[model samples]
Target chain A: MPKPERIDPTDARLLLALTEHPRATTVALAEQSGLSRNTVQARLASLDGGAKLRSFERRVDPTALGYPLTAFVTTQVTQRRLDQVAEALAAVPEVLQVHGLSGETDLLVHVVATDADDLYRVAGQILGIPGVERTNTALVMRQLVDYRLTPLLRRAAEQ
Target chain B: MPKPERIDPTDARLLLALTEHPRATTVALAEQSGLSRNTVQARLASLDGGAKLRSFERRVDPTALGYPLTAFVTTQVTQRRLDQVAEALAAVPEVLQVHGLSGETDLLVHVVATDADDLYRVAGQILGIPGVERTNTALVMRQLVDYRLTPLLRRAAEQ
Candidate 1:
């Protein structure tokens, strides 16, 4: 993870406006933030250039699309095969998000499968991967929230 | 809860492409799709208008930035307090996402806090809110994979 880029008050204001509405044009962003369109445009370009801002995106429902199985898989890798295990796990297309973590779980994996049968296939397949110590899985009974960069960006904007 | 808005293969393809690279111009989409840029643009316009392609955004990490604690708070509200509960939960600035889900959990909530202490305090504070029943939380230790929208969108473009 890289360091969070420094931002100004105006950048903060821009972030807030965008989190609620990511696609607001310069004109709209400026109008909402009380800045001129040009200024907003310039700042947007600069912020993006500075890596403080990235692209915008929409939120979609994965389940609605027939991917009914979602789970968070925590892995405890053997001391010898940790790196290899992470690499193999990261290779899967079905795995949505992977992160290295602390505590009993060295890595956490989130995967989406078409159904329980699909999930079973994935688990069976992954269990055979080299160096995997153990796995704990939590099937999502429901997805309260999936992913959105906006909220954190908005919070950063607030600061 | 609403119908999974009748979406088709072409629409899904378009979404997958845009979700992968929202900045990809209509010309590229046209080239990739063997369609006209004007047509691609037009379809995108309709999707945008319909709130299908609301906005594009990148999902970042809160833990990487020092907010290490993450939890999913499962909430249930009586019929009478449904609206009240939803509204109150949404008001909590720390609440990143609030959603209605299936199975035993009626609602799912995602929250980010600086640490366990912060998470505890925030969860307790939220419980203090009227109509919030006992909350169950599972702290995330790590992320193994993020099946983000972008990659799926990219695959759609390739097809």
Candidate 2:
């Protein structure tokens, strides 16, 4: 894991501005955050290159690519072949993410499918993977709150 | 829900190319995808306007903002006050996502915290929310397979 970088109020304020205006130029960000253009430029450079930013792939909604249905699969795998299991899961196109967790379940697998049949097929495929012992599928009925960081950004700015 | 737009092999190929080179210009995209500049421009405009893409905020890592610990809270809520529960969850900055799911749990809350104590506090806050019956949290130990779509895109292109 990369070292956690502390975000100061100024950085948070600038990030909040950028969230509101994703395509904003350095000058605009500076104006919005009440900082100099150079500071904004430097901060942005650091942010872009650092672990601060994740892949742009997150911006691409799977629904657009035809996989609309979303589900979480709690997977239990053999301890010895955990790495191999992860590799196999990655080979499955429907599996979007797999996070090892603490508790009854070993891994939380985020998946998307085109339909019920597709979802069933994907689940079965996951089950068939070597070292994968047990699996539990939970279909997402509605997204109560879409993934967001604006509120956190606001809090950071205040701090 | 908006109508699901069908994506052809050409569109998939273009999107795959864009994923690899997010900073690629329309002309560059055209060259890579073997399509005309005008076609690439038109497609990009449509993609930007359509439901194909999500918010740019997804590119920002919560870890970078000081909340490194990730957990999923399976919340059981009173059915009638689902909307209110969702509203309250949205108000909490740490609650990054809440998905209403089928099965025993009604909502799956994705959250991030600064540390164990922070996580406990956030979890307690969620449980304290009115209409929330019970809450179960599974802390993310490791991200085995980070969220991805390149394989899915490759499959789409093949189709």
Candidate 3:
């Protein structure tokens, strides 16, 4: 295990800049955070070691790509095979997101299929994973707006 | 407005392959799809004209980067400011996934914040948006997995 490196306010600020535009150059990030360029690089290196950094890559709309079926499936698992089930679910291509959620369900899965028929087949595959007892699935009717990370990064900077 | 371009099964197969590995060269894709490289490049040209190929980009993870606060905010809108509320809320940087939901709430927003306090600040900002009636939020504790196109594309290819 790596030692926990402390993150100062300036390092956090620099991270905010990069989160918004992962493509932001070292010089641009330094200017944005009012830090020296080398300082920004060193801080980024520290960030890499301490906390994971998710980069800014273009996120596409599934519907736009002809995947009209989307569902949020929540599952409850039997204790014994939690990790195995979760790992197996992760390997499935349609299940975009899997999580150990807190509410009524222990696991939450976000999935995409070409149509209702395909969704059923994919859901069956998920259900087959060991330890999965029950699943509640909600179909996405239509997408209003999708993903944009700009606001998230901005709020963190303000903090 | 972009008119829809027709995509045959072969075209769909090629597109799905590209979505799976955007960096895959046409030659490699040809080997995977069992099609000539020239056929693949021509399909790319037609899709570009129709705006079917939005972009090819690397997908980045946000949590790995330190902005770990992720939430889904469902908001109800006053009749007068439905459009304005949606637009304003969309303007916020933290709210990455915004949806005009149907049932109890008018919209559902996915936000990524730096931490717990940061998520609160983002929620507050959403509450401040004009015509915003009220908001309920579900924070994402873990992102087990995320955006990938291969699975969906594979189904399209089969069709």
Candidate 4:
């Protein structure tokens, strides 16, 4: 397997600038990061080329799209059919993320729904998947802290 | 309390266009979505004003930052000090997302670490929070599906 790409200090600083101002133009990034416009442009190209800077869809909010309820479903899947189970789960738009875990729970699925009734349907769909054995769902009552990456970027830049 | 801003079908089309081509320029979005450049620009402005289009930072991967290990930590906090516990947890850089759930668990913390040893340290710090009572953590062995919103956007656009 190929080695993972490493981000250097300057690249980290650029990422930090982007984290703070995602819509900043190359000139703006140059001004904010105290780097030349050419450097900012080149670094951005490198990051995008290496697939470090992911697509813009990551920034879209499910709540804004009318699916506000988020839930975590931990499921036990038949070991032999893990791949099939993942494929089936991926086909469900409500299932936002799926992780294979290290314990009794074989899969941890993060799902969102427009409401409780919709959540029930999504969960049922997951349970209906051939390889999914059992599932336990926990609804998110509130979001205390939204997902973030600034702290890590700041630390990397500092280092 | 202010009502949450609602996105119209036209706005949904623009968002779908952006999801398909995250790095697309406003001109590109206009052409792809079959909207005028002025309309695309205005819709973009409204989405930004409503705070519906989140910052691009969410696209950055912690694993790419060398924190390859990911874990979910469920904590039971002292009811009276729930806010205080949240504040403390927010102070930890490795804690990426925290959600207040509707069941026995009070908070579900999504965290990333440099490795298993680092994850241990991060979890220990979380457990050491003043109002934190009990904790259960599950390490992510593999990511079967990444976070995504394209399918939902496609559905919304089509509708």
Candidate 5:
């Protein structure tokens, strides 16, 4: 990962405001942040131009698309074919996120399925990948806490 | 969890188009999906009204906000105090997402930290939670694939 750019407290405040209202216009953001309209626009431009911002696709939920079952698959793979394994996993639509980790498990794969049978098929598809050796699937029974960043943003702004 | 509403191919097409261009105007989505503008607007309204859509906050990357290290902490907690444990975990800004899983580990916690020491602190905080029994941390060395939904959206459209 590239060196993360440190966001100032002012930036944090703006981000927090934006988090509250994602569709907030520049004028509204300026009003919320107590900054000039030009300042808001310029800061937003910088944030957008930098690596700080990401695409809005993550807002869409897999469950809404009919694949409600969520599972984490810890995978062991052949070291030599690691790249190929990732490539193959990418081709599987059920596979949502893959993270290489430091530990016994080589990769952590996030997948979603429509049902138990679909999950089985998705897991099988992953294991059949060229370098994938083994996988342990743990189905998510409930979401104790949904994905969130507001608290962190609050912390950042406080800092 | 509520019963997931199934999306038809037309809805999938519109969603897939939205996934590609999150800020696409209603007319643009209609053109992209070869559907009437009114139809696109109605479908989007329905999708937004239902439990299908999620907040856009997931688009904000933790790394960009000065927390570069990412780790998944599998936590075992007192079954009876699961709700309290989740509430305590939410109070800690570093704890991003937590899921109750069907496995030996009761909860999977996603967290971010500024560095190794910060990670240790975050882990310790989680372990200190009233009901949190044991926690295992797995540091993400690399992101093989980031969170995505376009492929799944395409599959839904094709279905």
Candidate 6:
């Protein structure tokens, strides 16, 4: 991770506005955030150029793309071949997110598939990786709260 | 979930272009997708209105907002009080995502905080939720692969 980039209240307001209306024009954002159009534009440019904001692609829903099933697989891997295991896991298209974790689990993998049968194949592919000792897979039945940051942005803006 | 909306090859290409250049203008998207400007506009509108595409807010990094620590908590809950548990978990600002899961665990919560001590408090708050039986928390040491969708988008376009 890079050094934490400090965002002022103005920037937080801009981000919060964008969170509500992502495709809003500069004029609209200015109106919503109560910031000058020029200020909004400059802040957006800085946030985008500085790598503080991620690309829009990260928001794409796999379920919308036909992969409705989501699962988390915790894998224990052979320590010596960790790098190889990570590389292999990266090659699997169904694997959306992978994290090296502290404690009993070596890796936590987030996966999505079109259906249950496809998920079986995807999990098998993950286990087939040479360094993977074993995997405990849990199917996500329902997402009560999807990934969100609106509350944080609101608090930041208020401060 | 709504009926899965079918996206044609053109839509896939348009999404792929957006994945690579999220801030690209309509003209740029039209050029990259090899579609007419009007077609690009229509496709984008359809995707957005249908809720197939997510807003840029989903891409915001909690770490960038001063919450550097990431942890996954698997919570076991009493079956009948699932809704109450979900509601309580949603009240926690640090809890980014909560998913009802199959198998032994009843819920999977993704959380973020400023530091280890903050994470401790967040976990305790989760445990404090009524009907939450027990929670197994694991701190994410390193994100080998963050959430992504380009690979799937590219494959969909190719097909």
TM-scores, all models, native as reference:
0.69, 0.90, 0.64, 0.95, 0.89, 0.96
> Can you list the residue pairs that collide in candidate 6?
none
Per-candidate clashes, comma-separated: 20, 0, 12, 0, 0, 0
> Worst 10-residue stretch by lDDT in candidate 5 chain A?
A1-10
- Candidate 4: residue A60 Cα off by (Å): 0.5
TM-scores for chain B, listed for all candidates: 0.73, 0.93, 0.81, 0.93, 0.91, 0.94
Question: Model 1 off-target regions past 4 Å?
Answer: A1-3, A19-21, A53-61, A64-66, A104-106, A144-159, B1-21, B24-34, B49-91, B98-109, B114-120, B123-147, B154-159
**Model 2, B68-113: lDDT tens per residue?**
8999999999988999999999989899999999963489999999
lDDT of each: 0.63, 0.87, 0.65, 0.86, 0.85, 0.85
Evaluation by lDDT, superior candidate among 1 and 3: 3
User: Which residue ranges in model 3 land beyond 4 Å of their true spot?
Assistant: A1-61, A64-66, A74-94, A102-106, A113-142, A150-159, B1-3, B6-8, B15-21, B24-28, B31-33, B54-58, B64-66
Higher-ranked by DockQ: 1 or 2: 2
The better-scoring model by DockQ among 1 and 4 is: 4
Per-residue lDDT of candidate 4, residues A80-151 (tens digit): 889999999999999999999997448999999999999999999999999889998999998788888788
What are the per-residue Cα lDDT tens digits for candidate 3 across B37-137?
Answer: 89977876676556455322123335643555667776788866666776787677666666554453466676777788988898999999888888877
Comparing 2 and 5 on DockQ, the stronger one: 2
Best-fitting candidate, scored by lDDT: 2
| Per-residue lDDT of candidate 1, residues A29-87 (tens digit) | 89998899999988877666565543333354445444657776666777676667767
lDDT of 1 by residue, B1-159 (tens): 655443345656766665555446678777766677787777766565563443344323354334657776666656467667767776666677765644343566777788889889878877877776777665666554444655444443454
DockQ of every candidate:
0.31, 0.72, 0.26, 0.76, 0.69, 0.75
Name the better of 1 and 5 by lDDT: 5
CAPRI band of model 1?
acceptable
Sort every candidate by DockQ, greatest first: 4, 6, 2, 5, 1, 3
What is the alpha-carbon lDDT for the whole of candidate 2?
0.87
Kindly indicate the candidate among 3 and 6 with the higher DockQ.
Answer: 6
Candidate 1: residue A148 Cα off by (Å): 6.7
